[model samples]
Structures are given as structure tokens and as C-alpha cells.
Target: MNLLVTGGAGFIGSHFVRAVLADRLPGLEGASVTVLDKMAYAGNFANLGPVAESKRLDFVPADASDAPVVGAALRGHDAVVHFAAAGVTGIEVLLEAAHRLDIARFVHVSTGDVYGSIDSGAWTERSPLTPTTPAAAARAGADLMALAYHCTHGLPVVVTRGSDNYGPYQHPGRTIPRLVTALLDGRAAPLSGDGGRVRDWLHVDDHCHGIALALLEGRPGEIYHVAGTVELTERDLTGLILAELDLTWDHVTATPGHKTGDHRRALDDDKIRRELGWRPRIEFSSGLATTIAWYRANPTWWRALQSE
Candidate 1:
């Protein structure tokens, strides 16, 4: 298969590309990949360094919002696994181009944040979207557009909504990496309010694996949830990171006025597991340790990004 992946230089997209090239993802062995990335602040070419030399890999540094570039990139690819979230414009452009090319499958990567905060219980594929943040609202709009194409034009779209992902190469702006990087620099990590925001933590590798399954086998116009292996509050997660680094609460400082929206987020991933046999293989404990070790050993990578 020849796969064109948008935002392929970013954290989750790069992992999918590396896995495809290395034959790590099942059903994608020996598949060639064309990566279309804008190379934005979050997009790092270094994330693809391991698979750079593969003859089957190709890289295009261009914005997904540019129609001419995106249309040209869509040629001769069997499917598109879009991870770019520049805006709804980019998604519409990709959808139009794929529809023109009659692409086999269009995997629109989305986030569980579209469901907003849930007081209790988990959100299913049938849940109504009630996005609060600008980013999530845009993503929710894009998801609807993708499904509309399937319904109106038969574009064979499959949407995968995943929970929060944490792994190496994630931009330091995110919560896990932010905390890990600060602790590594011997600086205090900031906690918002009481630090009790709830989140489901999915390893990036497992998240990508679920994406692959959805791309290969998911039904048209259907939505699948790729949930995390563990659920915890921000305070508890901070404690784990501190324990891993042999540090204490002294390294953590609470900011009184800061507020991060969404008190809790949880997803029911039984659909993907039952339909596609997808399950998260990495445990939170080991994944956290390895992620911290990665940051410690690769200060040059994260530090350079942080300095920019």
C-alpha cells in the first residue's frame, strides 16, 4: 500500500510513519509512506530520523491548507490518514482532494476532547459532541465534514477519536512532556488550581496501532474510540512523575489562579476492541519510566525545541 499521511512529522503521525516503514504495525508491512507535513512548531523532522533512510519513505514540507500542494500530494496514494489539525480548512481540502482521487479510505484523526468534560461515565461513538475549547470545536467541525462527505458523496471516511497521548517526541507544550521537561531541568513544575483535572493517558504507540486498525478495517462513516490504558487526576499523575525521578512535592508548585478547562475526560473504546481487536499494550508505569528516560537522555532534542 502507498499511504499519504498528513502531519506525518508530528508526534503521533511520525510514530505511524516509523512503524509502517519498520513493519511494526500489523497489516502494513512493506508499505511505502509519503509524509506531508507543514513542519510547524510542533512538527519535528527528527521524529522521523529513524526511518529517514528507508527507500520507501518520502517527505514533503508543505502546508496541508494549501490546496494545490495537497491535491498534488494526493496522487497515486491508496489512502490518507490525516493527522493535521491546522484547521477545518486543511481537512476540507484533504477530503476534496481524496474524493477527487477516489481514494480507498480516508481516516480523519480526531480527539475525545470533542465530547468536552463528562461528569461521570464514558462517552461512546454515539455521544453528541459538545466542544468547549476552540481547538476541540474546530476538530468537531472537521469530524462532521468528514462524515458528511461519506454520507453525501460516498468517500469511505473513518474517524478515530483518541484520548490524551503521551510518549517521546511529544511537543513539550503538552502536560506530560511539560512536567517531565521541567523536572529534568531542575525547575518547579506548575500545577493548575488544586491539580485535580482528570484525563485518560494513552501511549502514542498504542494510539497509532488503533489508527492502523481503523484505517485497514473500520467501516465507512463509522467512529472508533482509542482510549487510554489508565485514568488519573493531574495531581496523581504529577506524583508518579516525581516518584520516577526520585523527587518530591518540593519540585511542584501550585498556581492559584490558573484554570485548565475540562474537569474530566473519559472514553468507551469497546467499539474498537470488539470490532477491530484493538487494545492498548503499554502499561502506564513502564511507559512513564521509559518516556522520562527518553527525555533525560535526549536533552539536546527537547532543549533545542524549547529554546526555539
Candidate 2:
């Protein structure tokens, strides 16, 4: 079987590529994997470094918005784990792929940001989508488009919406990485407001694991939410990082945040657990500790991205 993974060079997508090439799929037929990425600011070649020599891995430098390239690449592939998008942009191009591409399964990686800020409670698959950001709105558009294809033409597309993802190989612009990198350098992380904003944070491993489970067990046209059990305020989380390194809250500070989504992000994930028997193994506290240790070891790794 052949797998075509869009955004394969990205944080989560690269992990998926690594899993497939590592032969993680047992009892599966032959495997040939192709990764199509636009090499955008978020896509990094370093993420795919480990699988560079794998015979099953094929890297195609392109954007998912380009239909012809994606169409040609879709030929002869058995499945597609669609992670490519203007991510926060939530573009509507994939609706075209549902009918145009020949694949057995279409797995889309969506985000909880699509649900907007929960304000006071958690959201479920039954929850309504009230997106406030252009990026998230684009994701909603594409997700609905994929499902429409399923309803209209029997296209087998399944979408997974997840919480904030963190850990190794993340672009510096994100939350946890930026926080850790900043604290390690004795610098203040430009945070949003009082940093009291709450979010459901998941390890990158868990996010990819959830994606993997969806690939194997998800039903057609289904939407699953992958979430960690913990919901933390940015202040509390940043404090944890500082405390781990034996620093005080005064050691780091905050700034205004992008008013794109909700001040908080919380989602209901019981469906993925009941349906796929999936849950996060790494606790947020421990994951943050390990993430801090990794940065302490690689000093210059993310420093280069500070100017960005």
C-alpha cells in the first residue's frame, strides 16, 4: 500500500512520515510514502532528517493549494493523511481533492481553534463551530468541504481536530517552544495579556499518535478531537517552566497576544477515546519538563529563529 501525506515535512506530518517509514503499521501491505509540502515557514526539512534515507519515503516540494501537483501525486496511493493547509488559514481547496484524487481514505488534520474559545466549558463533536480567526475559518471551510464530498460523492474523508501541540522540532513561533526557548536564554517570552488564558496542551507525540489511531480506526466522514486531559493557564505553564529551571516568575514576562482565536482553548475528546481507545500518555507537566531539558541541551537550536 502507498500513503501520500501532505505537510509531511511539518512537525506532526514529519512524525507521521517517520511512523510509516519505520514500518509502524503491522500486517499492512507494502508501503511507499510520498510527502508533499509547500516548504512554508512552518515546514522544515530537519523534521524529515531521520527518514531521509528510507526507501519508502519520497519528498515532493509543493503546496497543497496546487491542484495539478496534488492530483498527480495522488495517483496509485492507497490513502492520504491530509495535514497540509494554510493551517490557521483553513483554505477550501481540499474539497476539490475529495472528488479529484483517487485514494481509499482522506484523513485531515484539523485544530480545536476551529471551535473558537470555549470561554467557560469544553467542546464536543456535537459542539457548534464559531471561528473568529481567518486561519481557523479556512480550516472550517476545508473540513466542511471534505465532509460535503463524503455526503455528495461517497469520498472517504475523516477529519481530526486537536488541541495545542508542542515538543521537539516545533517552529519557534509557537507557544511552549517559544516559552522554553525564551526562558532558557534568560529572556522574557512575549505572551498574551496576563497569560491567564487557558488551553488544552498535548505533546507532539500524542497528537501524532492520535492521528495514527484515526488513520487506522476512524470512520469515513467522521470528525475526532484529540486532546490532553490538562487545561493550563499560560501564566501557570510558564511558571512551571521557570520553576523547573529554578527561576522565578519575575525571571520571565508577557506581552499582548494575537487576537485571532479565543483567549482559551478547550475541547471535548471522549469520542476519540471511546471510538479509538486513545488517550495521552505523557502528562502535560512531564512533557513540559522534557521539552525544557531538550532545549537546555541544544542551546543554539531555536536561537536562530528568534529574529523571525
Candidate 3:
């Protein structure tokens, strides 16, 4: 199979690409992969270094929103896996171009944030989208548009909503990497509000594995949730990072947060498990320790990122 993968140089996208090339993802072995990345702030070519020279991999440095470029690239591919931030850019152009170009399958990756925060139980795929932040709202809009295309134009599109992902290659702006990098740099990590906000964290490998399942087995116009196995409060998560670094709370600074909704976020992923037999494998403690080790050992990779 030939696949066109958007944001292939970003954290999760790169993980998927490498997995496919290594034949780690079931049902996609020996697939030829074409990567479309804009080399944006978060997208790094270095992320694909391990498989850069693989005969099955092709890298295209361009924006997915560029219609002419994307439309041309979609011509002969069997499917398109879009892992870019579609809410902010490119989902519309890619979906329209996929329709015009006759691509067979399109996987539109979204985030659990679209469901916003829920104070009680986990949100199922059937949960109503009531995103609070502007970013989440934009992602919600993109999800609706993708489903609409499936309904109106017979496009074979499947959407996957995942929780907070952390692993190697993640940009330092996120909570895990931000705190890890700050503590490494002998600086205090900032925790906004009261540090009570809670979020479910999914490892990137698990997220990509679930997405590969969605790509292979998902029904058209359906939505899948790749929920995290563990949920942690902001303060607790920060404490994990600090503990890993052997630092104390003095290394953390309290700051104002921009949250405007409920303090907790969770997702129920039983649908994907029952329908596709997908479940997360990595435990948070070991996964987080490994992640911290990656940052420590790859100082050159992240130090340059920090300087930028």
C-alpha cells in the first residue's frame, strides 16, 4: 500500500511512519510512505532520522494546506493519514483534495480536548462536543467537517480522538516535555492556576498503534477515542517530573492558567477496544521514566530546540 501521511515529521506522525516502515504496525507492512510536513515550529526533520534513508519513505517539505501540492501528491496513494493540526489548518483543503483525487481512505486525527472538560465520568465517543478553548473549538469544527464530507460526498473518512500524548520528539511546549526540559536546564517549571487541572496522558506509541487500527478497521464516518490509561492532576504530573529529576517543588513556579471550563478531562475508549481490539500497552511510570531518559540522553536534539 502507498500512504500519504501529513505532519510526518511531527512526534506522533513520525512514530506512525517509523512503525509502518519497520512493519511494527499490523496490516500495513511493506507500505510505501510519503510524508507531507511544513517543517513548522513543532515539526522536526530530525524526528525521522532513524528511517530517513529507508527505501519505503519519501519526505515532502510543504504545507498540507497547499492545494495544488497536496492534490498532486494524493494522486496515486492508497490512503491518507492526516496527523497534522487540522483544526488550525489544512483539513478542509486535504478533505476536498482527497475527494477530487479519489483517495480510498482518509484518517483524520483529532484530540479529546474537543469534548472539553468533564468533572465526573469519562466521555464516550457519543459525548457532545462543547470545547472551551479556541484550539479545542477549532478541532471540533474540523471533526464535524470531516464527518460532513463522508455524509455528503461519500468520502471514506474516519476520525480518531486521542488524549494528551507524551514520548520522544514531542515539542517542549507541552506539559511533560516543558517541565522535563526546564528542570534539565536548571530552571523552574511553571504550573498555572492551582495546578489542580487534570488530564489523561497517552503515550505516543500507544496513540499511533490505536490510530493504525482505526485506519485499518474503522467504519466510514465513525469516530474512535484513544483514551489514556491514567489521569493525573497538574500538580501531580509536575511532581512526577520533579521526582524523576530528583528536584523539589521549589523548582516549580505557580502561574495563572487560561483554562475556562471544568477542571478534569477524561475519555472512554471502550468502543475502539471492543470494535477493533485496541488497548494501550505502556504503563505511565515506566513510560515517563523512559521519556525523561530520552530527553537526558538526547541533549543535542532538544538543546537546539530549546535555543529556538
Off by over 4 Å in 2: 24-30, 87-98
- lDDT per residue, candidate 1, 1-308, as tens digits? 99999999999999999999999999999999999998987899999999999999999999988999989988999999999986678888999999999999999999999999999999999999999888899999999999999999999999999999999999988889999999999899887688889999999999999999999999999999999999999999999999999998999998773354689999999999999999899999999999999999999989999998
Q: Candidate 2's error at 121, in angstroms?
A: 2.5
Global lDDT of each candidate: 0.94, 0.79, 0.91
For model 1, the stretches where C-alpha displacement exceeds 4 angstroms are 256-260
* Candidate no. 2 TM-score: 0.92
TM-score of each: 0.98, 0.92, 0.96
Residue range 180-293, candidate 2, lDDT tens digits: 787777787656788878888888888878887887779998999998668888888887777888877677766876676588888889899999988788987788888888
Preferred candidate (TM-score higher): 1 or 3? 1
* Candidate rank order under TM-score: 1, 3, 2
Q: Provide the lDDT at 72 for model 1.
A: 92
Screening candidate 2 with a backbone cut-off below 3 angstroms (N, C-alpha, C), the clashing residue pairs are 88-135, 89-135, 90-138, 90-139, 191-255
State the local distance difference test value for candidate 2.
0.79
User: For model 3, how big is the CA root-mean-square deviation?
Assistant: 1.4
